[model samples]
Target: MGIFERYAPFVQDYIYRNRWENLRAIQVASANAIFNTDDNVLLSASTASGKTEAAFFPIITLFAENPPTSVGCLYIGPLKALINDQFMRLTDLCDQAGIPVWHWHGDVAQTHKSRLMKRPSGILQITPESLEALLLHKHAAIPKLFGDLRFVVIDEIHSLLRGDRGGQTLCLIERLGRLAGVNPRRIGLSATIGEPARTGELLSSGTGRRTIIPKIDAKGVKWRLSMEHFYMKEEDSESEAADIDALPVLEEKTDTAPANADPGLGYIFEHTAGKKCLVFSNSREECEAVTSTLRQYCELRNEPDRFLIHHGNLSSSYRETAEEVMKDDAQCMTTVTTSTLELGIDIGRLERAFQIDAPWTVSSFLQRMGRTGRRELPPEMWFVMREDEPDARALLPATIPWKLLQGIAIVQLYMEERWVEPPRLDRLPYSLLYHQTMATLASTGEMAPRNLAEKVLSLSYFHRVSQDDYKVLLKHLLKHEHLQKTEQGGLIIGLNGEKIINSYKFYGVFKENEEYTVRCETQELGTIVSPPPIGEKIAIAGHVWTVLDVDHKRHLVYCEQVKGKIPAYFGLCAGDLHTRIVQRMRGVLQEDRSYPYLMKNAVKRLETARIAARNGGMDVNPLVNLGGNMWCLTPWIGTYPFITLERILRLKCAESLGLRNLDTARPFYMQFNMDADEEGFFEILRAELAKDIEPLELIYPNELPLFHKYDEYLPPELVCKGFAHGVLDVEEVRNTVARWG
Candidate 1:
């Protein structure tokens, strides 16, 4: 039969009802693979190009034709919001076909989950963390829950391909297959997969099956892109000083709005007035600040608040309200969000998206921008760059508008080559190993130490972990009472381990803070950590609140609404700037080229920076002498290499060169005092580069660098090895030093 005829009736009916003129290329290709082949499938296509339906239509058809004896399919996603969205979409389609669709996540109702448990049939969509909980709490129900599972659908597969979370997902799938005694075909779905071969390999890691990545021809996509830059103040620029004085008085755009508002916030307020949009910030703190500022603008204007906020830290009610408001066809609302909404969540018919600054990767930019242009409209994005105006004696680097150039680089990279960040597979994932070890012991009843090590280390992610290293970890666990030795000489979860595993927080592999729930007279205002004393103010829920009372024992706080601005506190957030972005930033300083995406203020700033760079001779020399033997080195590498080079100089070559007083501006430049002359410096660096030294030499002796949350509990040596082999880009730094020769 043809692809259309192979759709098992209901899919064809749904297609006909929707009046789709023809099946999307992904759908046509996926139909053939899922219908004809027994192999797993990896479907890569652009956003809103029918990838979700493409993966599901064929799987549903198969389920309809040969219904499983138990739950038929398991859909996994990285984000709870994405899973919820997909559940709604699939539930609508399956309602007509008499196939039950269920979602299991934190936000989902327990009643719905209880129903699923009662029947244990149809599709079960869940996140990895929730799956971890399921495997632990319902160990004996695994076979009954998924005995005849036919397929496992992993959505936004690219997001899970690069980190321990991905490893955890793969491990969960492998464990599930073993426990249920069913080998389900895996289906991977993604809008951005830079390296298909690597992703295919990831998809079929322990499945003992090959993945078929269908080749689909996609047409060109249209985009409405614009970038604008703003100084924090008008008088900060010399040329704009007169214009600033001559311009009209700064009046409140709305009567109730606060006077003297932030220019960038005002600009966003004006642009997103009546449109359904997403304002994206890089961190949760920024997301909260932006939401508060926008809502303040609405209050000042005497208008109904049209702004909503979404992030990982927010309560589920708040996030779901935002999601539902954004989806409502009648409501014109804008949501200020972080990456919580960046994945493939179907929020119907968004008009535009606004990015506060440049994202770290081209993949992130694409994902943020892809949130819009659904429902057959061209994607539209506005880049808003805000920075403090440079002082009269501003240095070369400060004057160069990094965010503007970053936006241009992201666009150009995609426009020219369709480049996305590739997966980083070669890492010693010790953190995840620790998590999986705990999870394995908690899920299973008891096992001998040798048997546990053999089972856990044999997994694909822990392939590099040696038995000796595992022995060390086990010894530590025993010493700390994380595991107990029974009379039979088998390992079982102990009291300390029970305390760690029983907490809901242990379900997630990622880091989390100990948050106190905030409320105002029974009205919840989300969560906060380390709230100030009573009567002190904080911003949350797009409004300021003053602490009324503190209940530390219950981990709750009572607050009353107030009107003011204060910085909100979340945990730390760090950025990883790629080497390519830093290189392009250097080009922006050296080359006299204008990018089309740059707005008026950004254009002027770039020109000024170029002049300064030329005068400073930054283009001609990587190292410049300040006075005597004092010199500064400008190496435009990114964060990882910068870290590696710093260590290589301090630990590997410092004694030979008599280097001291080293100060760095992270991936940009370093200034140091050295006794070695220019020629001597080069000679020492060359000799050091030529020698073969272990990468572990850079690790400080007796230092346990606890990067990931779980690293503190791991063996110190294992943590050091993980940092050396995985965190540091030693090879990149070596290549850079070789260029100096």
Candidate 2:
């Protein structure tokens, strides 16, 4: 039978009712493979390309023909918000066909879960962490819950492809299949997959099935993109030649709020008025600041606050309220959010997206931009690049508009070559290994240590883990009473292990906050971590505040609201600039090509930076003298290589070259004082680079660099090895030295 002919009557009716001219190419291809072949499927297409419908249509039709005895489909999502959004969508579609859809997450109602438990059927949407809890708490119900599971759909599969969370999801699927005695076909969905073949292999791991990636012949999409630069203050632009007045100033309507507020925030507020929009920031603190600033503007104009905030730290009620507001077709609201809203959460039709600054990777850029342009209208993004104008004596690196160049480079890279950041598979995931070992024992009740080791270590993510290394971990766990020898001579969860496993935090694989709630006179203003001493000033909710008192025991801080701006620091956030972007950033300095996205101020800034780079001989040499025996080195490599290069210079060549007071502005440039000439420095570096040294040579004997969260408990030797092999890009460092040669 043809693909559409294989569909049940209800699916056809829904398609016809929606006036879909024909099945999307992806849907047709997916149906043919799913119906005719028993192999897995990997559908990779752009946003709003009907990938979800493509995967589900075939499965639903098959279910209709042969209804299973229990819940027949398990849809896994990386984020709880994504699961909730998909749950509603799938429920709406399935209900019309008399099929039930149930979701299980922390935010989900217990009543709906009880209903599913009483009579499990249709589709069950869940997050990986929630799935872990289910397997732990309802161990015996596995068979009855998914006895005849036909499909396992993993949405946003790209997000999980890199980390142990992805590995955990795969392990859970395999374990569930083994326990339920049903091996379901797997289907993966993503909008930003870098290596299709590798990710396909990952999706079908242990399934003994090949994954079919449907080729999408989609036309190029038109983007309403623009990038503009702004200084924090007009007087700060003494060194920069960018004429602020030359930039196009979007005129504000009289009905809109005053323009004296933060011009960037004002622009966003005015543009987003009477429309649904998403204002994306890089961090939670930024999200809070943006939301609070926009609300303040609304209050100043006597306008209703149409702004809402969504992030990982916010309470469920607050996040859900923002999500629901965005979803409401009648309400005109905008949400200020972090990456929590960046995934495939269906928030109805959004007018546009605003990015506070450039994202770290092309994949992140695509995901954030994809949040808009849903339900038809083309995707649009306005990038607001904010920085303090460089001083007269500012160095070479400071003169360059890194964020603007980065934003342009991201767009051009994807536009010209369709390149996205690839999955990083080679990492020592010891932290996650610790998490899985505890979870596995907790789920399975008890098992012999040999059997336990065999099962957990056999997973593909653990292929690099040695038996000796695992034994060390086991010994440590035993010493700490996290695992104990049972009467049956097997390993079981011990006292400490029980405490770790029983907590809700154990469900998640990502880093978490030791969060403290922020309040002002009993009204909560969200959360902060490691609050300052009483009467100390802090910045949050877009304004400064002084802590009147602190309840450290209860993790609460009482602050009276104040004014003015201050940097809000919660934790460390690092950026991973791709090699291509850094190289293009160099091009931005070397070439005089003008980008259409650059506004007047940005264009002038670029011109000034290019002149500085040329005059400083940045194109001809990696190192330049900055007078008085001080020098600067520009090495435009990514993060890992940057780390390695810095260490190699300091440890191996610094003393011989008489280098001192070496400092860096990260992946961009390094400044130092050197007595020896540049040629002498190069000779030393080249000699060290030519030597075939062990990875351990990169670290000092006493150094125990703790990079990962759980590295503190690991043996120092293993930790160093992991850091050297997994974290440092030695090849890039070698190449940098070769350039000097």
Candidate 3:
């Protein structure tokens, strides 16, 4: 029978009601794989392409024919917002079939959870942290909750592949399978995953089943893409023969700029007016700033606020309000958001998306762009690249528009090579190992050290972690009282460890800061890190507020709405870009090829940068002479290798090359003063790499170098080992330098 014919009656009825032209190629392939094969399946397609239905239709059909006694399917999402969005989509599809679809997360109601606990059946959707909580708190109820689980579907799987959270998810799935005594088939979903075959192996890490990735024809997607550039100061526009004036001006670009107003934000405000859109920022701090600026625009125009803010720091009520308003077709508004809204949340007919700057990765760019084009319109994105004008005597690297080149490179890399960052599965993940060890002991109570070691180290995600290293960790933990030895040769949570495991915040594997809750009377406004003194102003939820009172003991700040602008502090947020993107960025500067998507300002900016790059011979040499003793080096590599080079220069080759006063711009370029010439600098680097150089040698003495959340708790030796082995790409750096000859 055809796949469509085999769908359950309710699925078929739903498809008919929605008036699908025919079963999409993805849906048909998903059905064939699920119905004919015993292996796990991966459904890869673009956003708004009915990928949800593709995977669920066949799984639901089987459930209807032979429903399991317990929950049949477990859908794991990276974000609570994604689960909440899918909850509505699945509810409508499963209602007619009398199948229950439940969501479990911190924000979910306790009554709904209690109902599922009493009679667990149908589908249960949850986040990884919630699942971790479930395994730790409800250890005895595992069998009753998911004993008959048949399928595990992970959405937006790409987002989970690069961090400790992803490793935690894999560990949870394996642990749950062992506890429930069931081996469920797995299904992975994503729109912007790079290497499907490799990622498929990760999705089925311990399932003992080969992954079946169906080959689907790439869909033709029309994008309404535009890019514009701006100088941070208005006076800079008139100084250097403005590139923006080289081409025909756009109505959006020609908008009058207020002397004190940010021109780029003004452009966004002007275009997003009277439309339902999403303004994406890379960080929570940037999200707050953008939202504040847009609201100020509304006030200046004598119009009511038309923007909302969403980020991880915001309270559930504040975030949910934005989600609800965006989902209402009648509500014409825009939300200034961070990666929290970049997931597959159904926000109902979004007209367009405005990205304040280029996202860190191609996957992020695709996800942000996918927010639009849900209702038969082409996916649209307006890229606004903003930077300060270079000084007249600025270094050569400073003259290049790095963001503009990076943005173009991201677009071209995807369009030309279909390149997206693959999974970084090589990390030792010692932090997660420490966390899992603690969690296993906490959940299982006291157990023999050997048995505890066997259980935690046996997890597939911990394969890279050695038994010797784990022993070292255990010894350190015992010495520090993070783990206590039992009276009968077993291990248990110690006093220090108990304090950590007992806290509600212990559930997450991501980094977090001690934040104070901002409140105005009874309504909670979100959170801010390190509140200022009383009477100072802070910005959040798109409005400025003055601190009326500070209760440090309770971690609460009582504030009232006020007018002004101030930067929000939410701790540090870092980005790890791929090396390919940086390499492509160099290519953008070296070549004269013009992109079709560049707006007037972007096109002019590219021309200017190319000219500057060629004039300084930066397109040919990696090192450029800034002046007498100072030089600039453009590594043109991603985060890991960039870090490796930085360390190598300082630790191994610095004294030989007489390197002094080294200043770095992260993954882009670095400037420093040296006694030797350009050739001498290269010679020192090459000779250093030729020797027996260990990555661990670059780590400074007594430096813990805490990168992950739980790294602070790990032994300094293990932290150094993890950073050297997992965090640095010394090999890539060596290879690049060798080729430099």
Candidate 3 weakest ten by summed lDDT: 238-247
Q: List the residue pairs that clash in candidate 3.
A: none
- Report clashes for each candidate as comma-separated counts: 4, 0, 0
603-632, model 3: which lDDT tens digit per residue? 788999999999988887889888889888
Candidates' TM-scores? 0.94, 0.93, 0.97
| Candidate 3 structure lDDT | 0.88
**Candidate 2, residues 218-288: lDDT per residue as tens digits?**
87787767776777555322122112223444444434546556655665776788878898899877876
Q: Using alpha carbons, what is the TM-score of model 2?
A: 0.93
Off by over 4 Å in 1: 235-259, 625-631, 655-658, 675-680
Residue-level lDDT of model 1, residues 33-95, one tens digit each, is: 988999999999988899999989988888888877788999999998888889889998888
Q: Candidate 1 or 2, higher lDDT?
A: 1
Using TM-score as the measure, the top candidate is 3
List the global CA lDDT of all models: 0.82, 0.81, 0.88
Sequence-dependent TM-score of model 3? 0.97
Name the regions of candidate 2 deviating beyond 4 angstroms: 235-260, 519-525, 534-551, 554-567, 739-741
Candidate 1's TM-score: 0.94
Compare candidates 1 and 2 on TM-score and give the better one: 1
Q: Where does candidate 1 clash, by residue pair?
A: 254-301, 256-300, 257-300, 257-301
